[model samples]
Target chain A: MKKLILSTAALALVAGFASADVVRMGTEGAYAPWNFVNDAGEIDGFERELGDELCKRANLTCEWVKNDWDSIIPNLVSGNYDTIIAGMSVTAERDEVIDFTQAYTPPDPSAFAALDAGLDVEGGVIAAQAATIQAAFIAEKGWTLIEFATPEETVAAVRNGEADAVLADKSFLDTVVGSDGLVLLERTEMIGGGVGMGVRESDQELRATFDAAIQSMKDDGTLNTLIAKWEVSSQW
Target chain B: MFSYCTDPEALEGLAWLSCYLTTGKHMGLYISVVTVLVLLAITAPVALAFGFAGATAARSKFLPLRWLGKGYTSIVRGVPDIAFFMFFVIALDQGFEWLRHQVKCPDWPDAIRQGNDFVVCTAAKLPLSASPQWLHETYAFFLAVLTFAIVFGAFAANVLFGAMRAVPRPQLETAEAYGMTRRQTFWRILVPQMWVYALPGLSNLWMVLIKATPLLFLLGVEDIVYWARELGGTKNARFTDYPHGDWRMWYFFALLVFYLSFTKVSEVVLERIMKRLTHGQATSGGEAQRRANA
Candidate 1:
């Protein structure tokens, strides 16, 4: 019985090694245009479509998992999911933690959205998503930065008067400013490197697969088409 | 919603308001209230059962059992409830995955915990990475429930232990005099009598549990608070049919009313239960009732 149990366990271990084909893609499904959860409770939006296309092109079976933005990178390293297809900007600070594919979308200006234009952008309380380039920029400028876990919360902070303004991607604020008693400030500055898919540093082969897939899309103009369709950022 | 709600921006006043409330995201917010209620409904009885076992174990003649129950009740008391909720969920999740890893992959070589990363083999992944969306959600919800039950169970056990002791010794003596066995005496006398003493603490715990439901956001469960934040955020004209300003305060106010009414309803029910349990008992409430009747 002991020998049979040992052999059975060995077989199971072998079976476990054989089923490693599927790549789990994690995204903060709360971010719209980039990625968001639809009314049907499925992951929808730009990255969802792009991720599926990339997966098909790369010939890798992929599944999407929704995770909170704050812990997304940590969870990736911890093996919760294999790749982060969230709207994560390639940054030197983030590069220390995980590897990134080539830019899927080029760097876009991060704009300030406020109730009115005149609020002192430098001195006034500003909200940004935690761990984003905007938050780092705000901190460097010596402004009071109230960081939130998700991008939406940063905008919510501005709307609720918790902050004077919010600094986020222009593409995201473009959808928010006109109707929500908010107006985008004129002095938008480009921040961070282009957005890319993040993978664990150990997963070089997986990173190469996605890197090639992104390159193919870029070459065929499909990447630019999706960017325009989603109105994500300024096209590459 | 009116038929004219098809053109939301064109509609104004009460018509627009009605249409706004019936939006799909608003419906998600409404359903989240059911989620909180379901969590409470499932957790309360499970916590109570855990509490009963803990209290029984604490009172046992066996030293190890007594220590275990004592440790369970006291250890959680020192940590803040939120801290316990946050810590226990991750710990329990990792614990389950590690056990599964050991069983499923005997020959797999790497240490499961390498620095900060929990490197489990793919097959050991809880809910197994290949499971459906519902299974993933169900697994997360199940973990949340267990974490809640474990934390609240300790508090419930503390209340029950005191309640068990508060049961008069003479009542047990009377049962013994009637030729009852120890188990029979405990069931017929002690357990029945302990309820009246336990009611106040248990009701307070229920209220705490209700308030703590908001922490489900931390657990990554989209509870009412999450929905309130999501749906109440500024939705510009480009994003939604019923574009709104920061209406989070209003959504939160609605949640406030929901919780207040829920607590009010709970208070009335608990009062009736207390009255029922106190009836014809040796307590002051029972004595007052007897005097009033006489």
Candidate 2:
């Protein structure tokens, strides 16, 4: 039985497949302006545009993979995709597991949006998307934090009264605050260095390829143009 | 893809919608419906087998076996299915990787668990890092099926155990009186008659199992609920090709219709099976069937 089990596992291991040459770019399609699926049901947004350009510059064939935000990092680590071009922040904690290319977008302000202007954010229930920089910041402050699976849910939490306020990147909240009767809190916390592509630590070569592509985009002012067009964050 | 789908931005009306529904991501949503059904098909029988073993063990003459069976049913059934799903998937995944770590990287120097991370050698990664995307999806799906089987198996065992006992004591006595052994009596008389009693409980479990298929998203499988949420979300024109307002309500309504139709079909099939099982049995259903036939 032991031999049989081992042999079956070995057989499964040996059946390694797929085109190693095609770099799969994983993104959370729910996050708008950063990365989202358009009406044509195609991945669109700053990251999609930026990722395509980067892949082009790097001379790599790339495909998009839409993944839920909660498992994005783990999926990238598990080799479900070659890179996470999602609006992932560059943080020391995440750097322990995955290597990141240099920042493509400047450090975006993390703002709190509440139903009312003067809501006490410190004491009240705050919402943040799970596994995000804002969520970590909220947890570290020992504030009551309600974490949701998607960015939209965090905003919805504030609207539906499940949370007193939702803390997220200003780029994301800017679209929600004015339209949904959500008022941006005066308080803004700049948490991450910047948003960048995440690659597995072992893929230093792939990391280098993207890093170079990003650097070229930055140098030519094209990165800033895309960031300005999308209004994702502060331009370089 | 329709011919007009070639220029999605220009198209409007049903033609646009026809193209929109046929997009690659939408196809993923459609395929995920199959994923849910496939999960149901595989999990039901596996759960039944597990339940049979557990119920048999619960009634075992050996004290230890009875304790093991009872413990399996009670402990698993006591925990919420969601909690079990979240905990068990991670644990089982780590368990597999740990086993591989032991065999493949026995000489590794670093601790496996560091702070919040579960680090194993790259060689020990389940499905291996270089493996295909389908392999990753299949592995996650496999883990989900196992998790569902284990959790639902406990519920099934509870139902089957009650059903087994509900089989009349005199039926087993009759078998023993006819020179049959305890084992023979169980298989020949008790087992056959328990189905009529078990069907109602099992059918309820079947519905619960169907509802529980959406929890596959929590296990990282891109099942129907995930796609519904992803697709039905509002899209901005600045970011997407086919930007639209929130259509989650409509998408979820479609899911509601699908699940209702699915359960309706299941109810019809289960009713037929129950009728078949009740035929000539010493029960109210059996008696009714005989009377109707006469």
Candidate 3:
């Protein structure tokens, strides 16, 4: 029995580093501010900066990979990438497939940045993709509306004056509205978002290392400086 | 699942209810099927109209008009359909606005093309800058329809042009020999008989049109394929009232069944239409019809 326990512990030690210091992280380069690709072809978003800091603190070398927006979760579960640092929210459906680190960023009030006219999310029926917090908020408002396949379409709707405003991520709210002459009209109580790290179920040790790195960044003001540089936090 | 379903106390029952309501995405699933149907209903007629015009133009005596028709038909078959689907809608949208820009904002100094971006005057926006919600969706749906029609119309024109050519040379000669004008021969002898040849090709186009409807999702139209993937997945506990596991695969399976059944039903209906169109004509199909009936 003692031998079996030691073997199990050894196996656990091996499993912990499944995605060790040389971490392969995935981000949606299309989502601006959070993790969008700039004209220079480098991933230069808030999450990318934060991801770098976390890796630095963890003493891990990192390789960044660009992927399609929707495939992030599937790739994570299948071990295609070590972790997803995209501006993804923690939701019930995602919990089943993979584990997420505690939210590093709190969700800010979601609003649509309309290119055409000023938008008031309070009066308009909430329109967000289903299963998201935005969708839940719209449901809470007791309004019915359409859901789009991507943030790009949602933004296009506002630009075309198709939707009043898109219920969307905060970092995107700034980039889209700033670039397109859109304005955010409201704010909601912030919700916690899964904007930290992701690891496979077997990589509990890897997850712990990420959690420790995040904590260290917060302790050393690396997180704050990065946040200030990227302008990711609205309230910062 | 049923016994446990009402038990807020029992996780198993709650799981069932969660699955039931969240799987309500099935409603979205069915809506996409209608999207495919709507795409077909609109595209078929628009394509037929485009094809008929193209075929007519190709056979025209005038130089530019015939070239225009032949050009339209040839363009469709050469490039990939996806390329056309992507290019035409944007190109046509810009084409409309560019015309409008010249007319509406002619005094504006800025060039519309600045490197990579397209910037037109606010007044020149398609559907205008001040249109309502329904107008936008309708506008998108209409653009999608136009794209589908323009692409499929070329294929239809190919079928139609061949049908026109298949009419016997003697038939046209007889009309001319009997002192009929070219116009008279075309109308009296050629046009009506062409349908007997065209039905087989037209029927095939209809089946292809059905197959192409799923592409609506790619065009940003929230058709059935969009809804199926959205609604068919399993919900987890982080979500209350609709907690289930990943079920997207099963939902897509149902969609496959729906599409298969729809295609089977169409084949039977199209076969019947072919017989009706070919009946009592002088072509082989028509002769075969008469002999079989006799």
Which numbered prediction scores highest in TM-score against the true structure?
Answer: 1
User: What is the clash count for each candidate, in the order shown?
Assistant: 0, 4, 8
Tens digits of per-residue lDDT for model 2, B118-221: 66876777665555556667778878888898898999999999999999988888899999998899899999999889999999999999998989988778
lDDT top scorer:
2
For model 3, residues B212-270, the per-residue Cα lDDT tens digits are 87666444466766555444433223222454444567767877897789889988987
Off by over 4 Å in 2: A1-14, A17-26, A38-44, A48-67, A71-85, A90-102, A110-147, A155-167, A173-192, A197-222, B107-109
Relative to the real complex, the DockQ score for model 1 comes to: 0.27
Quote the positional error of residue A73 for candidate 2 in Å: 5.5
| Lowest-sum lDDT 10-residue window in model 1 chain A | A1-10
Query: What is the TM-score of chain A, computed separately for every candidate?
Result: 0.91, 0.91, 0.78
Residue pairs clashing, model 1: none
lDDT tens digits, residue span B1-294, model 1 = 458778887888988888877766667777778888988998888888889989999999999999999999999767897787666777777887888889879999877766545778778886566655455666666667777888889999999999999988898898999999999998989999999999999999999999999888767677998787677766655546776677788888998999999999999999999999998888999899889989
**Least lDDT summed over 10 consecutive residues: which range in candidate 3 chain B?**
B232-241
Instruction: Report lDDT (Cα) of residue A97, candidate 3.
Output: 64
**lDDT for A24 (candidate 3):** 72
Local accuracy of candidate 1 as per-residue lDDT tens digits, A15-40: 44444577889998777778876544
lDDT score of residue A195 within candidate 3: 60
Q: Model 3 reaches what TM-score against the true structure? A: 0.55
Off by over 4 Å in 1: A1-22, A39-41, A116-119, A159-161, B1-24, B114-116
Against the unseen true structure, what C-alpha lDDT does each candidate score? 0.83, 0.84, 0.66
Write out the backbone clash pairs for model 2: A38-B240, A39-B242, A39-B243, A40-B242
Residue by residue across A108-193, what tens digits does model 3's lDDT show?
A: 55655654455456676445654456767676667656676555556656655666767777666665555446676655435545
